[model samples]
Target: MADDNKAHTAISFHEAAVAAIEAQKERLVRQVTLLQSKRAYHLSAIRYYKGLITLARRLPPEVLTYIFQICIDLGYPRTPLNVSGVCSEWRKAALAPTLWSNIVVDPDSDERSLQRRIKFRLDRSGLAPLSISLSLSRSAVFMNVLAMLMQHTHRWSSLYLTAESSQEVDHFLGIFGRASFPLLSNIGLRLSFTGGEVPLGVDLQEPPLAFGDAPRLNRLSFHAIIPQSGLFYESLSLLKITSLILATTPRHQDVELLRLFTCLPLLQTLILKSKISIVDGDIGTIAEPVHLSWLRKLDITGEIEMLNLLPFIQTETLSHLHLRAVVPVSEEEQVQGSLADCLHSFIATQGHALEYFELHGFYLSAVHMSSYFTHLPNLVELQLHDSDISDEAIRLFSGPDACCPKLSKLDFRWCGQVTGKAMVSMVQNRLRGSHNLHSINEVTLIHCSFVQEADVLDLAALTICRLLGKPDDYCRGSTCCQNERYRQRLQLRQMFGVGGRVRKLTKNLIL
Candidate 1:
């Protein structure tokens, strides 16, 4: 009986222990499940917060829309439009009509792809006025793409076409003449006819008509094989052009070209690139000396002899002038006085009204500088490029009493003869006793090897002093002069000390 009891007790004890272990296992499972659920909930919360932050960082819809409009104005391939392609939201913003109003067809792109891109841009633009550009090579594919653009000419506000050959140009012009660019305001066409004469497929026996009845046409640029006849003038007369750039190879009727310019009553800016002889001949022959009173800017690249017409320029409105010598600098002694005299005479005549002047590949004597600056009261910016101004001439130009008070910016590059001492003296004199010295903001000295390191350091010091509004007291009295001398000595001593330190450091490195 005792043995049976012992067996029963052992059995009961084993069963209890097994039940306790099972309960512990169940509790562990519950705890693990709770931890997993909490972890999953925290992860979800983090993702939601991150999404909210990203949305907040995105540009406001209104600002995004404005940026898109600017991209359209600048034509496609603009940076803002590229940014708009970052994601779905941005892509939608970019596709808005206000953003894709202009389309530029790449000359090298496949015809099918170009057409698709153009069509996509147009569809996104809706009814907005479009600015279209066709960069065309001499290819059948280009011709086909151009024809497609012609179909939508009525919506164009600006058109630019570049052709590799005269035949392509002629074909483009033929298509352009037939189309109606009613809203076109600006047109730029660059044509190279080096291959051969432009074939007249469509008889232009009668001069081609204007592209359309574009009443607001204000700017036109033609760099091409301009017809010798006056047909181009007749075609251009339909629009009231304000700015015209005629960059072409010499034509037989260069005289007639000058006459053609008289038709543009409102023309304000004329950029003419022609041979010196041709320009001079045309100007000398003009009956009334063609008055362009409203003209403001003139950029001419030709020989100095052609500029004899400078005296006849009656434009009181002229403000900016850029003169570039097309030929090598004339070695003839006779031409020495030719350029300087002509420039001096022109400035003396119009210096009161001129503000900005840029001269490239021209030599200016000291006499010419003195003569020119005497009358230029309102001159603000002056740039001398590849000039032959000497150190003495530069000193005189920047003399203490030199009269260009309004001058703020001066760029002298490739002026080999100007020394560092002359430049430093000029700056010091100009800044002396002048409260407006700070107005002179930018001074560029490039390719001027004659300038020494000491002068460069002096210039930096002077510039810093001017910026800091230091005392304008000049070194005159012996005491002040001695003090200045002492300062220079101290500066030299410090430089030597630094050099020695650097040499020691370098020797240590070597060792």
Candidate 2:
């Protein structure tokens, strides 16, 4: 009996130990399950915070839309598609139709792919007004494309057409000129002939290009074209146009061109180009000057003698004048009412209102330059390029009696006669605010060999200075050269990386 009881006690102890181990195992499994749930919860929380910190998420919808529009304006190809893929919020913002409204049809792309892209953009743009730029070739395929685009003429806000020949231009105008573009406000047409010469005669049987119904058109540009009755009758009828750019042929006379300006009394900006010819007898006989009363900006490129016409252009509101003399004048021509004389006459009449003036490829005496400063007291910016402006002119620009009290910006390029010492004195006096003269805000010197390295460094300390194309000695140890190199490197980087395939769009906003 004693042996049996000892054996039973040992059996009961083993069973109890096994039961305790099973309960411990169950508790450990429950702990592991709870920890895993906590781990997943923490991970979820981390992802939520990460998304909240993104720039795309934090930006307001309107700001993000504006940045996207700028990207599109900068010609980021497939901008909407690219930005949409970045995130959900970006995709929502990219849905804006305004971002996809600029439709450009390049002549160089594959025909099939180009058509598909056009369709895609048109669909995404919805009812937004389209700014269309079409670069066309001699291919017949483009005709079908043009026909397709014509379907949306009512939606065009701006139209730019470039062609290789007059035939293409004629064909394009035949289609578009007849259609009524209710929203069209700007039009640009560039044409090139086989020999870069506009043909002598027009086919009278053909109708003239006219947009009689385009009442909203306020800006027009004609490149490599002359304004002729048979070619642009309706265009000339646009007396309400605020801006006009004309590239005239050598056949255009000074008086005829002046008469053309008289028709557009509301012109705010005018750019005229013609081959150089001295305006003589007939121009001086006019009783009254052509009053472009609303004119604010005038750019004339051609003969230095064009300034003679300025005496007949009466506008007290003209603020910006850019004169570039591209023709070579004989030494004899310079002696009789030279460029200086013409400018002197113009200043006497209209210089008081000039805020910005640019003179290129001409010579002016110190006396004439000082007279300009004296007359243009409101002048705020002066640009002199490849000219003979002497040190005396620079000296006259300084001191308490400075001529242009509001002058703040000076741009000098290839001005070999101007020295570093004179420039330094001018900057010092202007920055010191002598006689309450406006402090010099910016100075740009390009290929000005007389400016030394030390001068650039000193001027840099006083104001914003841009030095470029300097001589070897002047460039060494100067930040100007370093900054140029950095710009070049940055340009190269932008040209070859990420959005490299898409070229920057040319600005044709008609502003």
Residue pairs with backbone overlap in model 1: none
For model 1, state the Cα shift of residue 21 in Å: 29
Candidate 2 per-residue C-alpha lDDT over 197-310 given as tens digits, one digit per residue, 9 for 90 to 100: 455322211322445456788887766654444334434544477898876553444565576577678889998776645355467775357898899999888777677777
- Against the true structure, candidate 2 has what lDDT? 0.71
Candidates' TM-scores?
0.66, 0.68
Q: What tens-digit string does per-residue lDDT give for candidate 1 at 437-504?
A: 32454455545558654554566555521111113211122132123443354356445774333111
Between which residue pairs do clashes occur in model 2?
none
- List, in order, the clash count of every candidate structure: 0, 0
Per-residue error (Å), model 2, residue 75: 6.1
Candidate 1 regions exceeding 4 Å error are 1-99, 105-107, 135-154, 163-182, 196-208, 227-231, 234-238, 250-253, 273-288, 302-312, 326-335, 395-401, 432-439, 460-511
